[model samples]
Target: MTTTTETATHPLEILFQLQDLLLIARKKSEQKDRIPEHLQHVDAAFREISARRAERQERLKAAEARKKALEGEIADVAEKTKKYQGQLPSVKTNREYGALLNEIDGVKREVRAREDEILALEEQIATLKAEQAEVDATFPEEEARFEEQMAGWREEQAILAVDAERAAKRAAELRAGVDKKMLANFDRIAKARGGIAVVKVMMMASHTAACAGCNLRLRPQLLSDVRLSKEMVHCEGCRRILYWDHRADL
Candidate 1:
């Protein structure tokens, strides 16, 4: 069996709870908003690292191809030198022998040139391989770290979502218990006052009173109504709902 005093107190309690819920919701929504930006930065970091790794891999491939081609050229030059050397013993005349000898010298020069080209290519391959190895080794660790951080953030978001859901449910239950007219008034004032629909009056020196929401003087009648705490009251200056602060009396 609820009395008028108890029923009237319900509205204030519900309004307070509603304000709490809204505050918590606002904080959770802000955290949710930050998550997308954080995720974007993480994705960008991964993309940049992946691009660098791909570029390194392409360079390594090119270097390896050059090395293979140089190896083939060296092999071809070696074969030609072998063929020229085998012909040197079969030469029957000095002119033929001299011609063969000159041919051998030309083949040797070609081999030497091929060997130099192969050495340069090998050096390039070594540098490229080193760079590729470094990227490959470092990238996995970086990616793992980023993934771990993202997982933690996701977990936090999940927990916050659960908390927000519970808060929303409690707000809804409390709202249903409140009177329709009072709830509507609260909503209107909250909308007009940027979510500050309710405020407690603060007593001042010299028998004066001020609206806690806007720090404006209240009319004598307004003060009386707030003291009664029977119905909802509003501040004329800020239009915020007002209640008596019993703690101020002590």
Candidate 2:
């Protein structure tokens, strides 16, 4: 670690400042993490409603297509019946007349079946249209609510942005007083370990020092060096920089 030429500030004090910087950084990051989570529900609802609307529209289209097909079939059957009626005058034998009449009756029955199917499809189309109208009527309200929710999220994000900027500025100021080499070590350690670079050495019941970061017992010589605060002291278990509180007994 880089040694500080400044005699006024102790190593422990410098590490404490760095620790405060880390806390500020972590708090700002945590606040940013919550912003996206806050909008998750609103976003999910919007997508789900949109999917349902699309499905309804698709169903409506299918029903309309079925009605058109049935209508076409009914028209063709009607034309065939008219042709069969025209053929009745040309039939010379009683058997031919009877066959023509039977064919016309079968065509009429088919036409009726197709007409009934068309009516059913029309009814289905009307129901779908009504449902679509209801969905459309509520759409504007849902859109407005979604917009308002997004606006609220933006407002919260703006406020959190200001807080994050303030915290970052304070952390930068704290970093300026810290030794360059020590800060670099802390930065490296923090990147590897969840933003924690420094920890206290607590006096354990066994008259030994334990690392607060990992709760592992520290060696006597390592604890002694940490107490002196003359150089960087790292915990053997977690490798975090260790410090000693002057008020704490060993």
Candidate 3:
């Protein structure tokens, strides 16, 4: 990238300004889960109990559905057995009677198996329901224990949401003002460098310049080029865009 006329802002400087807004917005979101130290364990316990109850309820629903299906299967098997037994009076020879008896026995075995499964599913459903009831009875007291602290956490979360929203709006405006090529470069580098693409050259007491991103000493000619700010200069060590520090200490 080339330097602009004296009045125009350097592309890298614009990127630096854009970086500040983006970082602020990201930091605000990162703080969304902040909680009081005293209540952290209580909060975790409450969530754990709630999740346990939810799991129990889900399992109870599945068990009940299985029990209903097993009951229907038992009904179908019983009907088949009754139909086979009704054919016994029509047997004409010993061979015919034996075949009818075998059919009846097979269907009776199926009915017994379905009945056993239904019993097991009913037991599971009852256990899950009991567990759900226990949680329902105890959860309110736990919620009351941390009610005030949780309210404060909620309020702070709301405020953070507002701050993050404002930062997002401003960042969007800044990005819109930036050249697309510069914005793309900034995004690509920031993604590679943990959300920071531009950094000040670290001026040392020993009169050496270092790459702020990497802390590696800049080569003599590279340091000279960074000082001039005539064009975009990437640090040799870190490859992040380098700019002179404009703060008072520098």
Rank candidates by TM-score, best first. Answer: 3, 2, 1
For each candidate in turn, give its C-alpha RMSD to the true structure in angstroms.
Answer: 12.4, 9.0, 4.5
Q: Candidate 3: misplaced stretches above 4 Å?
A: 1-8, 34-37, 144-147, 202-209, 216-224, 227-230, 245-250
Q: Using lDDT, rank the candidates from best to worst.
A: 2, 3, 1
* Candidate 2 colliding pairs: none
In model 2, the number of clashes is 0
Estimate, for each residue in 1-250, the C-alpha lDDT of model 3 and write its tens digit: 4553456666677788888878888888778766668768878877887788788888888889888888888888888988988899989999999998999989888888988888888888788888788888977887787676588788888898888888888889878888887778889999999999999888785568888889988887888788775777889878898987544232
lDDT of 3 at 83: 92
- The TM-score of candidate 2 is 0.54
**lDDT by residue (tens digit), candidate 2, 1-250:** 4554545656666677667766776686677667487689888899899899999999999988888888888888899999999999999999999999999999999988888888888888899899999999999899889888889777876777778777677778878877899889988988788878888888876658799999999888887788875788899999998877654432
Listed in order, each prediction's TM-score against the native is 0.53, 0.54, 0.81
lDDT of 1 by residue, 1-250 (tens): 3333432454575687787797687678667557666588887888898988888788878877876887788788789889989888888999999998898889788878877877887888788788878888788799888888789788888888887778778888888888899889988888887777888788886567899889999988889888876777889999888877543443
lDDT of each: 0.80, 0.83, 0.82
TM-score of 3: 0.81
